[model samples]
Target: MNESLLGALRRAVGEPHVLTGDDCAPFLTDWRKVVTGRAAAVVRPGTTGQVRDVVRACLEHGTPIVPQGGNTGQVAGATPDQSGRAIVLQLGRMNRIRAIDAENDTLVAEAGCVLQAVQEAARAAGRLFPLSLGAEGTCLIGGNLATNAGGTQVLRYGNARELTLGLEVVTAEGEVWNGLRALRKDNTGYDLRDLYIGSEGTLGVITAATLKLFPLPAAQRTAFAATASIEQAVALLARARSMLGAELTGFELMSAVALELVPKHFPDQRLPLPAAPWFVLLETSDAEGESRASERFDALLSAALEAGEINDAAVAQTMAQSKAFWHLRESITLAVAAEGKCAKHDISIPTSRMAAFVTTTDRLLQERFAGVRSATFGHLGDGNLHYNILQPKGQDARSFAATQQDLSLLVHDRVRDHGGSISAEQGIGGLRTADLQRYEDPVKIALLRRIKQALDPRGLMNPGKVLPWQTMP
Candidate 1:
């Protein structure tokens, strides 16, 4: 960038907030370290006004801007390009919980407020913010919205898009759109809020948001159930949902390989039925009381056990035990990361066909690619699965990585064959840009481009993230 542009950026956000060279190194690489890039500078804007000013300055300089929050994204959605022409617009300084309306069950949180912090704030207000993920401690609500993140509790509370009531965004043209209404219903002509939610920052920068909240559950029960097969796990899920109804908050499935990694990686971790072919970490919650919740959980599991759907079961006796049960589920990602380099697929299929997809995909991987290990697990209640494959033991990491694209194609092609999405939760960052073009419908792709062009004509807002510059034929 020219000196004049640098000076303008420095003026927009103070000199101390404008980071350059080594100061920008950390933000250049993504959380997974899969995507790395170079940035002209990293700008820390303290407020929404400052964010707008920074955007205006970048636009004036004809420099692209990549908006980032928390930087805990699985895909490289927030990373800049290798050209080093983009400025990293880091929102950590805007971390603030603006307001908590207890009566309305709503809270206004800034873009950089940690997701766990928002949850705690809601809890302090005697409410619940239902978005729960493994990286909640550091992931920001802004990036969650940008990717339309879906976590374990999505079955109960819906994804990030549904949790949001309104958004405050800084458009690509450097205009602030304050659509931060806390109302539950409005017959608005056009719902622009939905446009930016999963746009992956390619549309505009999300600054703050009015989020929906719910009454905190009065009682909760978590249980780890073992099944003979994935099909049995699906049957157990149906039984739990049918019996527990709204009280069922989570239904997660993990293959034996996934469970084995926890103890292998996290030494302190332990599971009662680690050798089970498949395990479902399920939970039930009620507003009535703990006694009633416990009774329901036990009754449902007993029925499942009697029906032979579950081979074994363990219910959390205390809060600590409940957390431990959840820890087993949450630790899968970290454990897998510790294991070795693997190709990951966050895809979804019909709830009924999940077992068949897994069976078929596992067989295909074994038949086509010899000696690869698959660790499969995810939010079974919502039909999303994280199917990851580790390279054969003693295999060269570089040689194995060279086959990533081919391996991904094999899994994604099966996902398409089974009428599933290539991406269930994680958005198409620079990593899956080509996949989006290949798998997404041409008509939908065209519409997406039109919307992108309409909102970001100059294509300066996180260029080359979600949508490609040219429409796919």
Candidate 2:
């Protein structure tokens, strides 16, 4: 039966595109290398019709399908299971900017299109896609939508779910739903597009998207500021929002420990300011000229310093300098990874309670597990923090990693107490299915399972994802 199904898949999307053995290895592991899985074959489909055909073949043979894009997700959502009975659907060949309507401020891009490519396409058309992330260069737009990604600019522009106007999906029944409408005001029923955006391929395969665009800002300014504490950093965020208003595009908070790792791992990257307990990297996109943008940034930072909200600040003088500031912010993840095994949490809490939550959680972890270090940072503007707990110095890395479950439970329990979410920007992929079951309301989980059953009745669409398989009735 497996061989017959593989033959059908090869027929649907040519034999050359059907990958097996060593060629399938690359698509099996996730970005973080935390989990690896097996597959019968990796099927590359170049068009929506081909995707439909592949799905039809898989469904007919009762084979599970794991739809994968660039495979850049932090969670192993795109990775298949150990069953080896599934076919990994690779979408890289379908990459293409189908259309760009500058007047309507929308662009249609296939699921396989690299995120950076879509951004470049929008820029060439005198528009902005506004979905900037560290993985934009290699991550696919489909995966971004699959996860409903939130990046530095989410404070102003919003997440991928808000930026997407429509989607072109191939459903579990091996049928294409062309709901790619560009209208802004559609009194539609059910909102099926939204249902699939963050569903993480459990419902259907996202083949392409109709994405919203924004006008390119006239001038942009960036700054890196030092703060005495998380409280100070939060205060500065409030001040920036009040003063800059809509112009404030990004506000990222980084711990001194997080920043310290960059210099230790990459000697070339210099810290712009003296180390402090906390730091902020912020930016503003002004409709006015460069002079006006610079004036606004300078005024904002100076007021922050004088008001004692921040210790010191450095405004980027040029675009290169601005990129450098962002580079430092982006490098935190790599630095943390270099240190060794760590317990990571991507969570969001009410901005009002963020400071208290961090302080309390940090103290509790210290009390519970001695010498565990916190290397935390993230989009403070949107209230999402990558609160990561690193293994203690001189401790056995594996031993420290063994306590990850307990560490995360304490942190997530605190998040629950503070009115926060366990999974923030990152979707609850396979890695967090158990976490979802633990923290999420039983009613919500049941409803999600119903939706999955209604759409993929055979339970073959990316099984063991978003919704846990064990608890499914």
Candidate 3:
């Protein structure tokens, strides 16, 4: 960065908040520990206007700028490149809940506010934010909305995009786009808020948001059931939907391998089953308290078992037991990470085709990469499957990592053939940008490029992160 640009940035955010050298180290890497980059400085802006001024100053000096939130992204979307001339526009100090409208059931919060804080604020107001995720405690709302995050509760409340009401953004040229309207019914032209929702910051930076809220459920019933196969799991979900409808909040699949990994890594979690090939964690919530809800849930499982939709199933006897059972399911991600390097895939298929998708992928994978253990699991309710492959024991994990691109192409091609998405919940960041460009509709890709060119013509906002500027041929 030039001395003039540095001086203007200092003027916008103040010298104490401006970080260089060692201070810029943390913003250079993402949570996955995948890639690291160099930034000239990390500027922490305390307000949206300050962010705007910093951006404008950077634009004037012709210096590149990268807008970052909590930096907990899996795809390295927020990490800058090795240019070292780019400034990391950290929004950490922009954290604040501006206002909450209990009557209209909406809340306005800054981009840097933690997702968990938003949830808690809603809870305190006797409402539910409904955008729950594994990284809710650390991930920023801007990042979640940016990626259109899908969580375990997506079966009920929908993705982060649906839960969002409006957005406030700073465009590449430091112009403000105040699209934050909290109204539910707006026939406003173009639906511009959506443009920035999942654009991965290639167009503009999200400064704040107005989010929709829901009535808190009066009761919740959670269960962990063992199923014979993926087919059985799907059938069980169909039956549950017929009975519970929107009240059915979560339905997560857990293979035996995933369950085993938890106990192997986490200290307190226990294993109850004698190791089955598959399992399911089903959850339901309702606005009214009814003990019969739990009874009905058990009955649904019983029906599934008798109909052979599933072979065996179990319902938690208490809240503690329910949490304990869920501990096994939630720990799968961390446990898998502890096992060392592996090629992880997050893909989606049509809900009706999930069973066939799993069977085909599993069979094909087991056939090709000998001893490459595939621990298939995740939000089967929404067709989002975590098709992760583990390296063989007594072999180098790095060897398996080398085949990631080929495996990704094969997997994404299958998904595309089935009219499924290459990426389901996660956005196409650095990890999947090439695959996205290769498989996404040519016309759609063209439009995306046009939008990027119009808004961020300089390619200064998180460059080389989402859209592929050139075809790989």
Candidate 4:
């Protein structure tokens, strides 16, 4: 950038806040480290007004802005392009829990606030923020909202979009839209809050959000079980949902290969059940006491075993044990990461078609690529599965990379055949732009383009991230 633009940025957000060269190195790469980018400069604005000023200065200079939060995104969405001309607008400095209304069951949090911080704040106020995920410790609420993130509790609570009540957004042109209403019912006009929540920062910068909270559950129970197959796991989820009702908070499915990987990578973690073709980690929460929840869990598992829905079961005896069971579920990703490079698909289908999708995809991978390894696991209740395939044994890195595009096409085609989404929770970042274009409807794509043009006329807001690159006429 020119010296004049740097001067303007320094004036907007102080000289200390404007980072350059080595100071901006840490923010250049994404969390996964797969895609690295170069930025002209990194700007950290401390307040909403500062964000507006920075946006205005960037507009005046005609510099592209990449709005980034904690940078824990799986896709390279937060990273800048290779051009090294865009300004990296980091939001970490704006962290704050603005308000908490316990009676109203709502809390206002700034975009840069870590997700776990928001959860803890809600807990301090005798409420629950219900959006739980693996990167809750480092991921920011802004990125979560931008991605419409879904976690284990999504089956009961919902995704980030559902938990959000309103937003305070800074437009691409430096205009701040204060739509942070905490009201439950507002049918006044078009719902603009939903538009920016999952737009992945293409539309605007989400400064803060008014989020919904729930009464904290008095008691919770976690259980681990082994099932005969993926089909049995699906059946058990259906039965558990019917029997447990609102108490059924989570129901995760894991293949035997996933289970084995956990112990192989993390020696401290132990499997709760014997070796089986499939496993499930489930949890139930209620306002009632532990005894009641325990009895319900035991009865449900016994009934499932008798009905052949599950082969074996183990209910967590204590809180520590419960966390240990959850640890096994959480460690699957890290274990897979330890193994090697793999092609991962975060796709979802109808809950009923999950079993079929798994069976079909497994067969195709084995037949087409001999000796390849597969690990399929995710929230069975919501139908979102993280299906990953590792390179076949002794395969060269170059050869494995060559199969990614073809494998992605095969996985996405099967998902489409089952009326499933290629991206269930993760947003369409730079990684999946081409896949999105290939799968998404042309009419929908055209409408998205029109909206993009209307909101970001200059195409300066996180260009080439969410939407595929297109010349706006």
Q: Write the per-residue lDDT of candidate 2 for residues 1-473, one digit (tens) a residue.
A: 37788889888999999999988999999988899999999999999999999999988898899999888888899999998999999999999999999999999999999999999999999999999998888899989998999998999999999999889999999999998999888886999988999999999999989999999999999989999988888899899999999999999999998899999998889999997899999999999798898888888888999999999888888899999999999888989999888888999999999999999999999999999999999999999999999999999977997899999999999999999999898898899999999999999999998999899998988899998888543
Lowest lDDT 10-residue stretch of candidate 3: 464-473
Q: What is the lDDT of candidate 3?
A: 0.83
Per-residue accuracy of model 3 over 1-473 as CA lDDT, tens digit each: 57888888889989998898897887899778898999989999998889899889877876777778888776788888777888888887878999999999999989989999999999999999988777788888988888888888999888988988899999888989898899888996988788889887777889999999989888888877778888888889999999888888999998887678887888678876666789888999877786767777777877887888776666677888877877777678888888777777888988889878777877777677778777777899999988787787777867787876777677777778777887888777777788877888889888877788888877777777777646211
**Residue 443 deviation, candidate 2, in Å?**
1.0
TM-score of each model, paired residue for residue: 0.98, 0.99, 0.96, 0.98
Give residue 303's error in model 2 in angstroms.
1.0
Off by over 4 Å in 4: 471-473
lDDT of each: 0.91, 0.92, 0.83, 0.90
Model 3 ranges with Cα > 4 A deviation = 469-473
Q: Judged by lDDT against the true structure, how good is candidate 1?
A: 0.91
Model 1 quality (TM-score): 0.98
In the range 112-197, model 4's lDDT, one tens digit per residue, is 99999999999999999999988888899999999999989999999999999999999998999998999999998989999998
Winner on lDDT (1 vs 4) = 1
Candidate 4 displacement at residue 220 in angstroms: 0.4
